[model samples]
Target chain A: MPELLSDAFEQVQRDVDAAFDAFLPVPQDTRARLVEAMRYAVIGGGKRVRPLLVCATAKLFGVDRDAAVAAGCAVEAIHAYSLIHDDLPCMDDDDLRHGKPTLHKVYDEATAVLAGDCLHALAFDILTMPGTSSDPFVRAELVATLARASGHEGMAGGQMMDIVSDEEEYDLRQVTRLQQLKTGALLAASVEMGAVLGKVPPEGRTHLRAYARDIGLAFQIADDLLDVEGDEAKAGKALRKDEGQGKQTFVTLMGRDKARAQAKMLVDQAGEHLASYGNDAQVLVELAHFVVKRDH
Target chain B: MPELLSDAFEQVQRDVDAAFDAFLPVPQDTRARLVEAMRYAVIGGGKRVRPLLVCATAKLFGVDRDAAVAAGCAVEAIHAYSLIHDDLPCMDDDDLRHGKPTLHKVYDEATAVLAGDCLHALAFDILTMPGTSSDPFVRAELVATLARASGHEGMAGGQMMDIVSDEEEYDLRQVTRLQQLKTGALLAASVEMGAVLGKVPPEGRTHLRAYARDIGLAFQIADDLLDVEGDEAKAGKALRKDEGQGKQTFVTLMGRDKARAQAKMLVDQAGEHLASYGNDAQVLVELAHFVVKRDH
Candidate 1:
């Protein structure tokens, strides 16, 4: 099972990388700066969590795995764009992302911001391209899902909260609400998109939703755990930046030990959703474990 | 006809204003900053060219006028978002918008950036909400159109070219190419979306495209003309910022008289395309004239 999961993961990564490469625009002389910035932000290193969810969720439904791969790449483009904008000098003001200099840090903030804007548009372009989805309705749903997830009630809304809540003390409940929209909404959409695009039954979608929600929370908790316990070299972020920034986080809300346990419980629930799919979702299960177990 | 146009314009304005007021996110204490930035970027100013295009195009198909109004407001939201981001300290660094302090100037740059992000997402949200469109496919197409227009090949890409081409000399062909994507694409989408959502025939879409393309260029050229001839208070921008920045523009390439002639021809061609829609498209003709004839 472990070997099979590894193979699937490797294949998913290759497919996503190729799709992204194909979708990027040519960096002509006049537009070269913008294109270069976009390429730098997107091609920059990260786990590709959203893409993996898209592919894995589609694969579970036994549908067009290629469509899933394309969608996965598209979602990642949006994710990368968000990260680029979030790290601008004026926004989150981060100098680094995924352990490397942020796009603005590497290539001026204006380009970084515009590149992120382009990537957001590019995600929808990928989802709605002529051959990407044969069913117009499905294609439309794909657009709707992605747009909603990326917009006000989803990631953007969460970001607004994150910026405003910097100095405020929020209880775990409020923090979780923000995290659910900020981090978890897209994660849920990643899974839901795979299911819907693959034409999975409603029952299957419900289970996957549960699975994605658990994994999403678990992923954030694991991130907090890493911030507390991991290294600068491994995590590519300052080890205690969250604490130093006076930001609210799961680790700060629940003690370190409790956060770790919560992560484990959520991962366990994600696994429980996979029981009906059995070995078919082996990669997804391994991914859940990887989320909780990773140092970074 | 002028009185009727003014009446329709006023009615559209009230309805659109009401639409925005109805749909805007509540200014809760935590998210007040973001909400304020969004309201500032959207309310009280700008010509509403894109929104008017949406309204006129939808009117051609005899759809409920309110649907067009909703779409108009949504696209304006997107256009407004783009303007806010463009004026950010890291981007254009402009201090003023619509004769007032820019969003980033009034609020912090971080809030301004996030406001742009949130507004972009909100446009999609408005277009996709169940109330926005009766057909799910129409909803999807609206999402897809705005996304494509906003992405790498559209406004974002155009902005990139504008940034990179500042010092370089590009010929008329290259300049027009950049203008088409940067400004033309979204304008085209504005008209095309009305037709698409209204279920206008494919041939009608073709006609609308030609109309939109011509007027879009005309609008840009007229903008160039305004830079040369209009007052600073009226234009809400420092006159000749284009020349000062060493940017290429239509007025720069052709003399002011020639640019005006070119704009008039385009406006005439845009009006000609409405032959297919017959008397139903009077509003569209007025809109085309407004694009070329407006002072601000």
Candidate 2:
């Protein structure tokens, strides 16, 4: 990605953070614990990849940047909620995330669970705020899209598969299918949501989806690579923890080198989707690269 | 509270069971175990109160039954998910529900957690199906409304309060506030969604909100009353368990007689909201009575 585009992405991230920080319901004693948990989970620093997709996809289609920001933040809320719950004792049981304590580890398990639940609901609430979407029909479509991407056939199902797939052997195809649903589903939705915001042409929408899927897979592969490399500080959580847990991962199914090669190939395919847009997708191009190159 | 209306409510209950039974995705292996747990949690018979609200609201607005059935199903899915998660080992730790084994007790804790997560997502997925809502804007609104009602400001928050309120004394006002958000918010949404579906006037919508709110409180109050005099066979889970857990219940805060009197008052207020609709709202009237008078 170009330096200017990188700077622009950072600005968007800042704005998204500011919007969420400002708009969340005030601190009331009745819900003080829940409110605190939500704040911690949401504001805890991360790469903000999903929000970037929403911003970049909207910009690619020449829509108002302001319009995409709220929706973008909403998607991030869903992403944050998933992470919080995924790290819970009854779920993945991780003690750390993004180089910080997991929500459950910081607050109590009950608070973490409630925080996740609230965050998921808040995502839809933000997207449906009065005057957020230009048309009610469009707003509905966005809501439906986000819900499908986050729900049973999407993220939740993938999580179920991931849990069950642990200790089981699987080929690349099966692993890819699992990752697509678990990780790629929301990424695809993030890009598609931007297209919906801009009302992109059918062809453009299709290409954006193709781009999201390719990069989403690449992102997971890179994550596996980082885990194998023992990049504990950068990668966060316990390093190589997947192997110890017998979780079926790209690095476990495919050799580490092969996983890296596959990630490169996926990124290349994602880039091919942007050829149609020429230089308009500079941020997305950089994002694809960042997804693979980052140690964390 | 007419006899004919009560019969109509019973028919809706049957429809709810059939819908959940038919719509559950077939489980595969471990997933099957998890899905089965979800099915057991949802399929266990109840009053189907939320679904009834959806149907009744839709009918009030003159929307086609087919168009509104998805929304009805979606609300129940959410309600079921809340129950499953709430009954987990870390949460309520209940071993029974609807006179059967609870999800976590029947399945493993991890599976129970995932089942709840999937079911929660499933509710969103069902609501957002391609053709579920003809008007996309309405679909978005429904999604947003449900999220709010189900999230921090509504169900989740209510639960958090319930947990905290224990070990502390609370007056009737505080109890009312807690119950309003817990059960009342979603109940109000059920009526509002129906009105939204039927394209009712703003005044009519307000009336539905008032009706739902009043009945929702009455419903909870009656529930507390039931715990005081309930049988295990009729009430599903253990009765008086709330007091055993040191829960701050309405009956505990106020004498049982006072609680019953308050419930009756709320039921009367709920009935007044439907006075404008005459016989058209007979089912809702009966529902209000049923909520206050039911033993289980």
Candidate 3:
């Protein structure tokens, strides 16, 4: 990784961890277990890619650092909650995530469910906090954006498509739609929310939106590639399960080499969309390349 | 029930149902099952107490009826989601809710979990929409209030306490605290968000807060009492489970007679707090009376 992009990732990880730690203090009561489970799930995992995306995008408009970090945390909270719920027995039933036992494996299923729920609410809670942004319009828009991205029409809806993927054979277009909703929506929202925090109006965000859209698809394609080829030890979760489940993916539909080429193509296109910002978007351009290249 | 409160409940039920029906239109794809589960959980069940609370409280400040109903729908979304999750096999493992088979029973566990999560996101989505409130501050505040009320320190935290209640012998104080977080927080938020939509400042909401607090406890006490004595057919769910699980409750701690008397006293006190609003608060006062007096 380029030093600038690597430094950005490291800084976001530290900031997001500190923010979640400060945000969730375990009570000295029976609720302690719930908070503990929530902390366990949120405090110390994931690539912090969403936060980095938010911070990087927000940096384009000179948005406040703390406010950007707070927004990033809100998006991460949604991401974390979804992972917890997705790993439940009734869902993906995964026992591993980020190289550790999943939340439900570490805690009971009920605790996992409640903790996921608490984290879901925490996302909105963080967004509406004055620390996120003093501007009510910004805060409201942030909430609306994240809510729509994570709700039925977006991430959750995509997840539903995934759940049914096992029972039905989906073509490339259907798979693209599903991945767009499931994974692409949140990624796009991360960029959009950063732009929102920067007070960039909807019309001024055309390039940023394009950049996000391209990277979102590139990221998912890369994920499909990684699932088929990456090491579980490095990925920190089970891989190659899609093939085992006979689920069609970017790799399956397009073949591994073609999918790899497509991911790279999308990433390059994503960087091109940021060309208007010139050198100011270097880190974003690097980040786009990293998305397709990342092994995990 | 008094005509005023009964009418309020009837109106809220119709309005909330209509709002949910409109808000959640099933898609024309794989996502349909998930939306179906969400609609099944939300559209046609429950007493709509939270919506009534929001509308009644908003009425005190002459807040727009449609906006209040939107806010009410937001709160109801949270309530419905909680019930859906609480019925999951790894949670309460219930097979029924609102006299219907639980969401997981009717669909599947995965659908129920996803539906619950989707509804959770829908709550914030609704609150931030233009129809909920045109003022950005109001929208932001509504999101914050409901998020806090439903998150770890509120409803989910209360649920955690309830999950552990079977093992721990809780006293009245502990039980009260648990109930306050679980049931009281969201109920209080209903009134608080209503006042928020009406642009009532925090300092100006003391009486309203007190009214919510009193009725919140009264409502729970009535629930515990009903759990012990009410028929399952009337209650629309499995009753007496608290006793079966050996959990501590108002009835278990205070005994049935004292619990009933205390509920009545709290209801009377709740009405007193709304006395300042006089005739305008009559519906709220009747609702308070109905809290302890209802059979279900």
Q: Largest TM-score belongs to which candidate?
A: 3
Q: Give the lDDT of residue A28 in candidate 1.
A: 57
Give candidate 1 misplaced runs (Cα > 4 Å): A27-29, A201-204, B27-29
Best by DockQ: 3
Q: Mark the regions of model 2 whose C-alpha exceeds 4 Å error after superposition.
A: B1-3, B27-31
Prediction 3 TM-score vs. true: 0.99
For model 2, the DockQ equals 0.69
Cα interface RMSD of each candidate: 1.7, 1.7, 0.4
Distance from true location, Cα of A109 in model 3, Å: 0.4
True contacts kept of 3: 0.96
lDDT, candidate 1, B144-239, per-residue tens:
788888887788888888887777787888889888988898899889888976887677588889999998899889888887788888777667
The clash count of every prediction, one per candidate, is 0, 5, 0
The candidate 1 chain B region of ten consecutive residues with least summed lDDT is B24-33
Collision pairs in model 2: A136-B137, A137-B137, A140-B140, B57-B194, B61-B198
lDDT accuracy of residue B274 in candidate 2: 89
Computed on C-alphas against the true complex, the DockQ of each candidate is: 0.69, 0.69, 0.96
Residue-wise C-alpha lDDT for candidate 2, range A174-231, written one tens digit per residue = 7888789889999999999899888875676877888999998999999888777857
Q: What is candidate 2's lDDT per residue for B177-247, written digit by digit as tens?
A: 98998888888888877877776656757788889989999999998889888888887787887878777
Lowest summed lDDT window (length 10), candidate 1 chain A: A1-10
User: CA lDDT of each candidate?
Assistant: 0.81, 0.81, 0.93
